[model samples]
Target: MQGFKKAFAEQLRLALPSQEVTLERPKDYQKGDLAFPCFKASQSLGMSPQSLASLLASKIKIKDATIEATGPYVNLRLLESVRSRETLASTLGNYPLPPQEKKNATILVEYSSPNIAKLFTIGHVRSTMLGHALANIYAQEGYEVVRLNHLGDWGTQFGTLLAAYELWAKDSNPELEKNFPWAAEYSSESTTPLHRLLQLYIRFHAEEEKNVSLREDARAWFKKLENQDPDARRLWKKFRDLSLIEFNRIYERLGVTFDSLEYGEAFYEDQIPGVLNALDSKGLLKEGENGSKVVDLSEEGFDIPCLIQKGDGTSIYASRDLAAALFRKSKWNYERCLYVAGSEQNFHFQQVFAILSKIDPWFKNKQTHVPFGLIKLPEGKMSTRKGNVIFLEDVLNEARDRIQKIISAKNPELSNQAATSEMLGTGAVIFINAFNDRNTSITFDWNKVLAFEGDTGPYVQYAHARICSIFRRAGGSWSQWAEPRSEDFGRLHFESIELPKSLQGLDHASAQHLIFELNGLEPALKASAISLSPTSLARQLLTISKAFSVFYNDSPILNVEQSEAIRQSRLLLCLATARVINQGLRWLGIFAPTEM
Candidate 1:
């Protein structure tokens, strides 16, 4: 299909000298397979579109290909033999191999940034999975992508944590002596321990609420930490170290890796000054009530002002974000920068981008915010503080366990339990999320997620495995016969082959339909990248798989009384279908197992 589109596009370039023609699938398959609007061509030639289309229809002659005019649309029907050869070749060829001219574009994808002293929540999984998939897609497109796990390693939350740690220091269990072990233990502890810490934080806030002097003290402590005060700095490092240990374990389980690690706190010390200067230089900084510095985006309809600096001269989230953006732009020099964050933070990113654009207009178009919807629990929204969130690790383990049970039931003799567990478990979870619309809230349902049938990842993997089984049954090297070809094999006949009535004829009509569908891959991939919607690609894979399924059920490669040439051709088609499925699945971070 892609080849046909390219061929048509080149043909149009030569035929329509003064007008641009777009090759597109016809609105209805009956109107001919592919269509080119002749409105522009007609205008260029000072004739009616229908007349111009009719003229071109007579000139273009393709083998077994038909051309027709439908009003202003010039429709082309692909030869069945040509499509069969093309689809077979595409299925056999290594698709989406590294492009020759690899773009030296650096992209910093900041995602899965779970906070320190926090467990991995389902919401965290959404960002982690989505970001990793996007990174994979970008890499396939030949971009140098840097996956950054921007851990929430620093914040005022640490101040509260420090206060909590000090108060609960003595009650620490030796078994829980590891860093941030208290995070988990604290969840089960009496409210006494956490309540005390919360009270201290609240007390500090209340004291500073009216007394500017007390607020200055908290700022002084935070500044001391930023300035590398021994005690404050040591405590901050301990929290960061402990949190990373937990985060890395989760990342490994999820099969995600980062090229760089940047602390939100690290930016605070040095990046804040630069950001403040840039804001001041642009004359965008404004003094707000209560002695805070802010960016007023009221004109942009964002009701809440972005707090750049706190009342006590302390930098805030907006300040760190501005610094991070500048530092990233300078270091990576990325052609594109995508921020994979929750949709709830839409305003926050808008402010960040607005501030960056004000500082450097060149960066205005490069920065993008890839927002995704939330993952809610059956009861309600999950909250980390409430300890009501499902840990991503727990979800993964549960998925593995479910797959193990199914494997035990279906194939008790299977060895390599670990490998099978990983494949089924990870594949199931990824497919569940990837198949859904990115903007819709996903309710974590075990039954739906673990189902082996329907539009799940396992179903696709099963289809690939089924093809492998067929090859195994053939008892010959499938790879040896599979090769790319430009011309169609003449042996294949749609009328003789018994296929599903829906996909019966492999004549011009069916071939054209298949060709048009195949042409959508590249554009679909681009759309998936732009929208961060894996479902688009998922749907395409499903379509291809279903088409192949019909072909497999109807066409008999081994038993048919045909020449070696025809058998090899059909085998090559099967191989190409398998390759496309594997490549597409890989993009979604889903594995395609050779066997079920």
Candidate 2:
């Protein structure tokens, strides 16, 4: 597929040396699949744009492509046969994919770094799914992908937790609180560690407004924790571990995994001094208000210098990020490291990357901060302290329960109800946000997510299941058409079943459209991966689903009266659609259930 684009580009480059040759998609299919505008190139050639396009359309020789001149644009369409036998076959691995244009190298994707001490909220949905899908797409492109969950496990938050814990101990008594059912040491039978920590943290802030000294006490505790004082370290470790236990449960339920789970601020505490020393030696460190130390990124256009060290000699988040970058570089030796963070941190990252670039040139080109917009409820942005935050686990579980109830009402006898309900419900939550533009804030709407029609996750998954049902009903389905039956076809092996001789000559709008959609799988996947946006692929998958549905309605597979041969051929088409949909949804981190 890439070869076609390259060959076409080379042809145009040879004919028009001065033009920036690019193949654009026509707004309407009638204009052709790809188009090249010739207005500018025509001037150099001393001809009208339409005339130049016509000349190129006639002169450029492309096998299996029909070139047409439309106004000032030259449009081209691949012959359906080349699409069916070559592109389709390659996507199904009757042949290998065109050699990868990119060299195989490692990339580390760091996402879902929600701060510990607070439960994961509805806000994390976009980053987690976006990062997950990008990782999947990167692997599809043959990159050595490392998925890192950069847990926000360090910094002043831990200090706040320690201070709260100390206060709670004094007020409630350590012995009594320890013996309480939901204790610091979580057990297999008990829960609520996360709730306890969150309550303490929120209450500390609340009480601090009444007694200002509480804030100082919290800061002191955090400083002690940073200094690795025994009691403070022990308490900090307890908060960190218990928080992770809660986090792991959510990750497990949501089907998110990490190759590495590294603490951000705490992990870099030991190296932060050296980070400051390097900045100091290089004359990058500037004195900020009071005794604080900072990096002057004013030239990068900031009003205030980026504070690296506080007045009390404590390191801030920016300093931790700088040290973490150094740690990740030496540790993974990755070609690229993407930080999937919220869009609010855009300037913060730019400043950090700018400061790091001053200290280490290698940091500038390789590191990327992939920012996304906020996830807001219908009312507005939520806050944990205000008690308005929606728990992520609750949302996921509700999605499952609601789906299960619907299944019970609609298809009471459906097998594997528990498992199917879980997948579909979780997919609903994920799908609602999957196609949203990364920089646009999305308002959660249950009505929209659970909708049966339109581009919902259930809608796509149902299409896969519907295709599966077609094949199951067409018993002696193409799989057993051969002398010996083969196992089910996967992404790489769809060509195993030979199309019957009579079916080989199959050509109709339905067959042609289905094959076209099937052949387009690779290109859509490529575009999605390159753009680092899952919605591109998500939108493409929806197109394939709608196209397959049209083909399903217009073309008869098992019920056709013509002959068994044509029936089998249509069955092959159905199998191909199911395979593509299943694989595509998997890449999107959504399920394509075999049975709806």
Candidate 3:
């Protein structure tokens, strides 16, 4: 397909020597496989679009394609035989897909920065998955990706948790038994540590409403923690350790990893002083309301000043972020650093980037804030302070449980049911999260997320599995047949596929459509990477799956009555489709099961 596209582009260039040529696909596939709009060329050539299109159509000639003028567009359609040959060669050949050249660059992707001692809630899913997918996408396109967690370990929230723990949870006290009875029951369990910490956090906020002094107490505890008070440091470290233990379990299930887990907000505590000194030296630091140290953004068109430190002399998130950015730049020298976070913090990032621009003007272009919308339950938005949140682990577990039941009933004899069900379940969750544009808010629904049909993860996974089943029934594995040139592989080889006469009906149409759809994978990957959105790639996978499904129903790859050449050709097509679905799913951090 790449060769075909390049050849056509070259022909169009030769045809319209005076005009720059760029080809695009028509909105309607029936119009053509590729199109060139003549509006710009017509204007430049002092002719009407229709006249230019018709004139160019007459001049351009392709070896295995037809060129014609449709209204103001010059359209070209490759013959079915040409389409199949080129597409299969591209998809199955040694150098396949992701036609993007080597970037020779590094991308630093920071995501899944769940606060230390907080639950990995569904609210965190959008950033976590979006960042993970972006990292995978960048890596696939040949960028050195550095995955960062950027844990939220140093904040007033931690102060509140510390105060609550000291007040009622550090020991078996009457307050703990009276206020949170279930905490004692779960105290001895391995998972109870983080859960109990969450309860303490929630209790602090709930109690603060009745006790005004609790807020001040929390601030004081945070101040102590900043000053490296031994007790405060010990408690914070204990809570941070427990929270990470719980988080890693979920990350394992989700199949996400980071290059550096040691770098959190707290890790930059010592560097904050240097950041403040630099700001002060540059006259960017100012005394704001309540004696807080700030950077006035009045000239930057921002009404609100960026707070660098609190009135109590403790550093704030902005200051820590400044330090983190500097540390990242000094350490990784990344070509681009992407911060994947929620939309609510758009202003915060703007201010941070603005301040960085003043300090290191070159950095403004290197950093990007990839903001995404929040995930909401049917009732309303989730809140960690109110304990009105759904944990990510719970959602994943529920998906696994529900999918397992369906698999149990549908395929009773299926081996590896447990692993397969888990894969399908998690893949379902991940796919739905990525199915839409990153900035669009999603209302989580059980039915939609777990759906097995119609543009869903399971639908695509099933397509791959069905193809694998075809090879199984043919007494060979897909890996053996799909890549027969491997040293030990021998089943299918690159050969001319003469379709049986019967395939010329609906089967032929669907087969050509499938081949064309597969050709779009490279373009889709490029679009997804450009927009930093996984939605484009997700839609492409679904499109490819649907096309394959039509071909699967319309054609039979193993019918004994058919010629072996026809069967082999169809099987080769199926192999290409399966490989694509497998790679696409894996890139999006979803598993492509050989059996489902």
Locate the minimum summed-lDDT window of 10 residues in model 2: 482-491
**C-alpha TM-score for every candidate:** 0.81, 0.89, 0.93
* Model 2 error, position 290 (Å): 3.1
lDDT digits (tens) for residues 1-596 of candidate 1 = 65567777777778877577787766565675579998877886899988988888877765556877778887887656665555444433434221325778777678777766666666787788888888877776667888876676665666555544544442663322233332444443313333233334444444455776654455566666665778877877876676677677777777677776664556456778888888888888899879999988887677988899877777777788888878778788888888888998888899888878878987878888888888888998876544456666666777788878887888787667667677778787887777888788888777776777777777777777777767777766653332222211111111111211122234434333444455455556677877877778777777767666666677676677866665655555556566667667777767666665
Q: Best to worst by lDDT, what's the order?
A: 3, 2, 1
CA lDDT of each prediction against the hidden true structure: 0.67, 0.74, 0.82
Clashing pairs in 3: none
TM-score of 1: 0.81
Give the clashing pairs for model 2: none
For model 3, the superposed segments whose C-alpha errors exceed 4 Å read 94-99, 174-191, 477-507
Best by TM-score: 3
